[model samples]
Target: MAVRISKILLVASIGALLLLIALDNVFDYNTNYEIVSHVMSMDEVPRDSVISWRSITNPTLHKLLYGFIIFTEFAAAALCLAGAGKLWRERRAEAVRFNAAKNIAVAGLALGLGLYLFGFLGVGGEWFQMWRSATYNMQQAAFRFIGSIGLVLLFVHQRDD
Candidate 1:
């Protein structure tokens, strides 16, 4: 029971974190938009680098990408919150039922993992060379998010028996 409660709380916490992040991005649009813009533009990378060709100089594309990120964050948060609620309602159910309640939470966590790992790290860090930008680098933060969310995901997926 304690473990189940812990899982529920952890999922809820992740949901809250994602929700706050999405809200922050919306409320303080320019702050994060700058980061995204810089990363996509690749202007911060070495001037002589050949990969500069991959840079996306279009402002409209930047806005669209940023919007997609926020949408994904909000979707993950909603899924996590709903999953936590489902877990809470089934906390006292039999092992099978409790385990079944984890489906939504797992989906949410997976979505978060995809966002941080593939979206930020893969696309931003590798493809866009965001890691080269001292001011715009988000690799560390994205790594932290991936690690924490991955851990919670693993714990939550454990069988409830």
Candidate 2:
């Protein structure tokens, strides 16, 4: 029971975190937009770098991509919150039922991991060479998000017994 509750809380916390991040991106639009713009533009990366050719210098595309990112975050948050609620309601159910209830939470965590790992770390960090920028680098922050989401995902994936 305690473990079940712990899992519920952890999943909820990730939902809350993603919700806050999405809200922040919405409220403070320009700030995060600038980060995305810089990363996509690769403006801060070394000028002579070979990957400069990969830079997306279009402002319109930046806004579109950022919007997609925010949308994904919101979707993940909603899934996690719903999953946590489902888990809470199923806490005392049969082990199989409780285990089945984890599907939503796992999907949410996996979505977040994909965003941070593939979107930010892979596309923004590696493809755009965001790591080369002293000012626009977000790999560390992306890594942290990946780790947190991945850990919760693993914890929540355990079968209830």
Candidate 3:
């Protein structure tokens, strides 16, 4: 039962993290939007090199990207919160039944992993060269986010046998 409780707590903590993330993005919309905007526009690239062509000059694209990010965060938060509830309800059930309740949490974790790893680290950091700007560099933060939730995802994925 200790293991079950641990699993439930871990999953709930992740859900809380996701909830905070989503709320931050939604409530403080412009703050992160500015980050996304600068990263995408590459305005602080610090040099007049031809690499500037890679920057997005359109304002519409900036809002679109930011909106997409917020939407993804909200989805992950909803899934994680719902998953935590499901896990809590099944915490006292048999091993197979408890394990079955992990599906939603798995989906939530995968969504978050994709957002941080693929979206921020992959596209924004590498493709957009967001790491070059001291003002807008979020690669480290994104990596940390991925790592923390990823460990929980792995832990929660283990069979309850």
- Per TM-score, the best of the predicted structures is 1
Of 2 and 3, the candidate ahead on TM-score is: 2
**Candidate 3 to truth, TM:** 0.93
Candidate 2 weakest lDDT stretch, 10 residues: 44-53
* RMSD of candidate 1 to true structure, Å: 0.7
Residue 76, candidate 1: how far off, in angstroms?
A: 0.4
Query: Top lDDT: which candidate number?
Result: 1
In model 3, how large is the Cα lDDT of residue 34? 91
The global C-alpha lDDT for each of the candidates, from Candidate 1 onward, is: 0.96, 0.93, 0.87
lDDT per residue, candidate 2, 57-102, as tens digits? 8899999999999999999999999999999999999999999999
Model 1 regions more than 4 Å off: none
What C-alpha lDDT, on a 0 to 100 scale, does residue 25 get in candidate 2? 96
Report the C-alpha displacement of residue 43, candidate 1, in angstroms. Answer: 0.6
Quote the positional error of residue 151 for candidate 2 in Å.
Answer: 0.6
Per-prediction TM-score to the true structure, in the order listed? 0.98, 0.97, 0.93
lDDT of 3 by residue, 1-161 (tens): 88877777877787788778878988998899899999998888855866777889788999988888888888887888788889889988999999999999889888988999999998899778898898899999998989988998999999998
**How close is each model in CA RMSD to the real structure?**
0.7, 0.8, 1.5
User: Candidate 3, after superposition: displacement of residue 153 in Å?
Assistant: 0.4
